[model samples]
Target: MTISSPSSPQEYIKHHLHSLQFGEGFWAFNLDSLFFSILLGVIFLSIFHRVAHKATTGVPGKLQCAVEMIIEFVDKTVKDMFSGQNKLIAPLALTIFVWVFLMNLMDLLPIDFLPYISQQLGLPYLRVVPTADVSITMSMAIGVFLLIIIYTFKYKGVKGFIKDYTLHPFNHWAFAPINLLLETVSLLSKPISLGLRLFGNMYAGELIFILIAALIPWWSQWVLSLPWAIFHILIITLQAFIFMVLTIVYLSMASETEDH
Candidate 1:
């Protein structure tokens, strides 16, 4: 509805941090994050589809050229990192990179722009940066984790996958239990670390933006914010690239039969 302007800096930061949430713990959903994420994803697909449909061999449009560049970059990255023969890896990596980059790109928007519009439309809260949300990042990580399991089974066979957990690091009957424990922790840590790393960086970036907005004088805000915003572009792009590369590497490791 009609959210009043915050009276103090703390109130302002708190208001900005709040999500448009529904339901209770576990069942609760961050509607803003979900909405923006899906919207950006659709936008990514639509732009690519339009470019591909209109693509010409001679004198390509700027949009087509940009799209082709991204596709080639992602294809090359996957080719370099993924040793497996699966056809899905390249497309998956491309989607992860572009989709996550789009989400992170939202953080560059003026912090109050969307929220102010949303307030006028009667939405109570809106957090536009989906990658800053732990649940969103973790959900993507879980998807990658599931793919790792599937690839391990497909390329290594069930027996090899079992041996990966049982007869690994020490490679002895006496060390099987210890190996299982160590491998299990390592396996679980993949998703956790993957998700948390993204969330931590983006959340911190979002917080700094909020602080700049809340604490700085309106007339002087741009003096500091402009430089930070420029630097953030690099951070967002690097985070997306790292996520995609790590996904490719993890799947490659899973596909290999030999232990590193």
Candidate 2:
């Protein structure tokens, strides 16, 4: 099967941007993102399970060493950020980090490879990176936001959560309204920021890949794409790390008492 270009750049971007949706407009659900994220999560979990099952103290394998390093890093970050004693936080943080990093790493694949394969198989569109989609990122962020609210209420109680919001920073009758309003906005902004940061970075990186692909003279595409792909490794890893750390920080803050 021969791969053909779209009629226009708009068409090209539109083809790449379209998600496998399950519904309409605001209610539309991206089936592609859900599928890819779940797939990646399963893959990550499988790798971790295999490593753990085969782990030995006598001599560490490469996969075991890598997993251990990641675990230690996540453990340290959790230790530093969270002192409220939640058994689930560290594992959750590590999963988020590894899952997101894997999703981001999808951008490293040849821009045309998946689309070409999909087209050959009679599927015209396929976006491999779930985090690159705004809807997916926003959904993850919103989930985290809800978790923050849940943990806040659970750890601090509803009254305490509200009290902290009202009394935080500047605690005065006059400042109460302003403080509450500001605090409310801050809480709402967290998910939006988290979503936007990941979406923007991945979206931009994907766009650059598309642009680079469009510049192909067949022979030179491989040479130019190689360097761009190498540089993108850094971008993907950095975005994932940033997203993971921010999620941990937000969760930790939510779990904090009034003193913190």
Candidate 3:
């Protein structure tokens, strides 16, 4: 099989953005997104688990120290923001923050690194960052949305949940229908905004990386790429933090009583 180089700037961006997909229409799957997302999840989880399980009371290894700092940071954030006590929120927030950061970190690698390697191994194409895919982001946000709904029902009861949509904001019986419409839109918008914000940021970052690689002179590529990569480090971390914080905030809201 021949290794075909991208023919032009347009073709390059187009190819880079294309997922290794299968099937058709609504039934289609982004194989590349799923593959990389799962792989990164496993990798990050395994390392953290190993470091934690083998953790000692004495001096910690560098890897253990780093992992502990991340865990502490996430734990502290959960404690500060989440009001109600549920054993699940801290770990969930930790997983989300680390998993998202790892996915975004893929954008920092040389634009052609993974794709070139995959092509050499006879794979058609690959996009390593999963958060760049809107579907992947939506799926994650929907998972969080489901959790919020679960907590709302658990804490507030079915009646309370219904009442939340129907009352309180407008606080008048005549405005129940109007309040429901407004609150329903507000509730649904959480996941939609969560997903789109991450997707848009990541997709734009990946596109810029691809643009830098495709449009610049090969001899001087790193000049712009290096700075962009550096700035993107902040972006990757901030995006992950924002996602986790918003998830916490949403769940916190769900667990709150209307009387409070």
TM-score for each candidate, following the candidate numbering:
0.97, 0.92, 0.97
Residue-wise C-alpha lDDT for candidate 2, range 5-71, written one tens digit per residue:
5777667877787766778889977777888899998999999999999899888989899999999
Q: Candidate 1 residues 123-236, lDDT tens each?
A: 878899999999999999999999999989998899989999999888897999999999999999998999999999999999999999999999999998899899999999
Off by over 4 Å in 3: 1-4
Count backbone overlaps in model 1: 0
Q: Please estimate how well model 1 matches the true structure, expressed as its whole-model Cα lDDT.
A: 0.93
Candidate 3 residue pairs that clash: none
Compared with the true structure, the alpha-carbon lDDT of candidate 2 equals 0.85
Q: Rank the candidates by TM-score, best first.
A: 1, 3, 2
**Of 1 and 3, the candidate ranking higher by lDDT:** 1
With a 3 Å backbone cut-off (N, CA, C), the pairs that clash in candidate 1 are: none
Where model 1 places Cα greater than 4 Å from the true spot, the runs are none
* Clash count, candidate 3: 0
Model 3: lDDT equals 0.92
